[model samples]
Target: MSFDSANLERAAAWLAQIARQRLTARAGQLVETDLGAFDYYEDGSWLAHLLRRHQPSGEEFGILMLALSPHICPHLLDTVIAEVRPEGGELPELGGVRAAGHRAMLPTGETAQFFFSGMNMSRRFDIEGMFLADHWFARDRILWLESVREGEPLMSGRLIVNPEIIEELVTGKIGRPAFSMDFPAEHIETAMDWDDLVLNPLTRAQIREIEHWVKHNDTLMDDWGMRKRVKPGYRALFYGPPGTGKTLTAMLLGKHTGKDVFRVDLSRVVSKYIGETEKNLSRLFDKAENKNWILFFDEADALFSKRTDVRDAHDKYANQEVAYLLQRIEGYNGLVILASNQRANIDDAFVRRLQAIIPFPMPQQEERYEIWRRTFPEQIALAGDVDWRQIAARHELTGANILNVTHFCAIEALAKQTREVDLRCLEEAIKREYVKEGRVM
Candidate 1:
């Protein structure tokens, strides 16, 4: 996937040739250019591999090259356009706009039309087909036409290539995107493995079933020809008490199945303005649709809660948001996991649509004992009198609480200049956890 300047150079040359020929033809002159002689498909470079796989038409290749030329050869289009119009006047047929801080002319949908179809309005439809919603470029989120002002022609929008795709073409890999208002989801990972997770047999079995869907649902739907009958994506509900390994289980699921897990930030997702919630979620789902990513909607009740009777305008729009979310999640092609403290918080409509609802109850005494035994770091030592069994039997602490207590004990031991966490330290740490939870020891 290394960047190959030669491929980009060849593409730029081809596009430049097309621009010259089209401009000449439009200027009351006949131009015969054998564009078919161009050979851009011969190599092991990233662009060549992409061209070979997608096999775009000559005109479609020109559009892609034009979109990419901004990054690789910034002055390519500017030079060609300047040659065509030496008087330094704008050409409306070659649609483009000057971007802030960029000296070169950025291509727009109209620019693509001019390059490919020239003055032939009939052939413009053929160029339009390349930007259709179902097209590979759009579906894969590689490139698209940006939104334009209301009443403006769609072709007037800027032709945008995805930054990730550009990075892949320039660099060897695509880095994880940063979490922001636009994305509203964070890429989450864990070094812990499945063996580290302690779940009940029922929950474990249910999780295994989800893993099956992640690993082989493609085969069942495509190879087995069940796509027409079965839904496109897998929807699962993970509900239980906080700190009961809900999030950890999700991270572990992604780890075992080799899929990235993204936790949607509800605070960023739910907006006060009308239609904003749907807009935010739409951006999230649109970016995630083609990526086989596991969307972990933690504390999902804020967005997917039970809808209320329409008592006010707020209530009606809230219900509409829920409806929109349902449609979006159901249509998503990958796994969607909604994690909440309780199943009752989610709407019954969502519950009915869920393929699996797995509960992560608080750990039992035995599980808590195991958690306590494994919670402490390997470098830390437990005092001889620190009876973990009795501690687990007496105090009910979730895995997260156990880790918190262990962290406190480790810090206390370090403060006292000791290598060991004594039973008294453990007791004090456990008491602090209870106090934080408003529970009496």
Candidate 2:
């Protein structure tokens, strides 16, 4: 028979065993069957097949069986069988007449509760539940369950695994749960490298330090127990003028480390409602924890601004939001880079907590020339008269502005139907950029 058929048959057999045990217990008679023998693999049973497929080491089969416990429970198995075979028929025979029912009959009140809590008592199968519970507390898994709001005593909550896990089981490929549901940030595709970044010696060294920290993070945090002594994360502040390479540096760090970069959109994070900002940030951090992700907070001054005096309710709540963020950042066991144009605007409390504060200074004349030289592709034809040194000296522009002028000049050359970019085109591009910025050029 097919895998599905075999799996369902095995599930039915397990449920039948549960029914027999329950009936025997209700009758107050001494059960004679060797329940321990049932744990062994039958010749053509699903456990035997799984053992062949996985070839796990000692006790792994027991763990896998425990993980499958909830699925093989009488209620869920009956529900699945009923849905599959609507035109009901007797369950496949295992041994006793008690196991011949078309559907598992629901036990009344206390007995019904016993099915979920006591079904595994004989096997002492509590390890899987304990493992999952520990992971939930460690923030490795999110638990969603129904609970009473306020002081009311509602029905007891049951652990509901997320849909991603359910999908993995159905596909027979169990893996880590993907946080697609209620994830608040967007993943950024970083396409930068060392060659694309232009900064001073100190800034470059600082960037290299950040990369090194990420590379040996596990050793420093786990092996050395630094997570317990110090903060469990690396928080760096990239501060400089607009158009300096702060954002690019953050992206390059993520690319070099092979980690996904998520630029947190402050617009979405800073909610108008009370306590909403904390909720949003908590969700983002919970989803990102242990996921090998780099959290990039660009234009961070808005979110990390200095806390104002409590003149009103807005001011008080705003400080509370900042406090919440401070706690979350400290607790995160990953990389977080916050970029801001003005470093002075950031709160002193945050600055004190940061591991590194690297300032991205505007490019000097020599650096600007390097940026211009490297900006164009080798395939692009440039006029012999295009003087990089003169242009770098004439315009007090950031690296970003220089790139804009280069692009504009190339497009201008293309419009003029020329294969070569000339000095005049470069000058015109620079002039246009200055005009856009309202500079006296």
Candidate 3:
């Protein structure tokens, strides 16, 4: 559903009512108030959908609104502050902190406690329960309380709503995170379909198994009552030479399954500083934990290679990073694909844990022929002299090689002001590919 301003307005009103009541109570007025009177789950809003899906308790719902208040309506609380202390001073009881960029005060955990529990010891303890490590609030990554200074009350921490949640509520869609230091994976997708992929029957069958896991893993784990016995998520190792279908297969899997594919850049993921690598990986995995994303770690051998004997601190830490990676990937609840040029490059620890190890070897002659025939679009015509079967047999080019040749030929055809690609152009393109790869014609 689209952003519903009316529902947000209603929620803001409810928050304002509660805030005013709390402020009035602090001023020696015992005003009767029923916090449950407002509809926390209004029909048709993104927040409402989340509320319905999670079904958080009344206290939990109150905390969520308090966390979301600044983003939606900052002035609402500022006005409450003005009313309570018109002389303009900090209201410690209302609990908030000033941000350099944010003009108004942002709520803290203490704010939520003050708004909901109002100094009642029992109620405050319940609010504290919601922020515990295992609570859905933190586990689902919906919201959390920021860390406080040493020895300070935990309630003093600033309340933080997940940025994705805020984006979804405001724009009615969750924004895909961009590639950065924190999130080093880039989103990848393919316009090509399964029909365009060329693989041997055995390899194709292995891929199909991965597809089955993606489609029915929840059933296997939950519906079949195997959750206790089996581990969460699927792990696969895609080993192959360059230009084989390893990466393309990953993209196609996501395309066919309707899931996002994120290729982790190992250069960015492996930090030189001790413990930094795990932190970088943790940021990536934490964001992806509930996203059901297919994480493609291309050239994964750089990170997942066999460990060496610890001769130094660096060696010890490197091995530790690999162990940490193994534990994290095993615990992930979605598909994790580690692609490398060779299977032997990966550590045995990762291999033994893999559910599937599919190889993308160099395409055989028949597969190469199919690839050549399928590379060109229907808009481009092949000259009568062009022979795909002969070329496919002679060159032994990969699917990617054929595609590169097709692209070169197509561009040449367009340059020559014609819709047709001739045998000469095709031969020249193939020669270029061979030259680029330092291979003999």
Q: What is the C-alpha lDDT of each candidate?
A: 0.86, 0.66, 0.87
> Which residue pairs clash in candidate 3?
none
Give the Å error, residue 144, model 1: 2.2
Selected candidate, larger TM-score, 1 vs 3 = 1
Per TM-score, the best of the predicted structures is 1
Worst lDDT 10-window in candidate 1 = 28-37
- In order of lDDT, best first, we have 3, 1, 2
Task: TM-score each candidate.
Answer: 0.92, 0.74, 0.90
Candidate 1, residues 182-272, lDDT tens digits: the string is 8999999999988777888899999999999899998999899999999889999999988999899889989989899999999998999
Off by over 4 Å in 1: 26-38, 41-45, 84-90, 378-384
Worst 10 residues of 3 by lDDT: 28-37
Ranking by TM-score: 1, 3, 2
* Candidate 2 worst ten-residue window by lDDT: 91-100
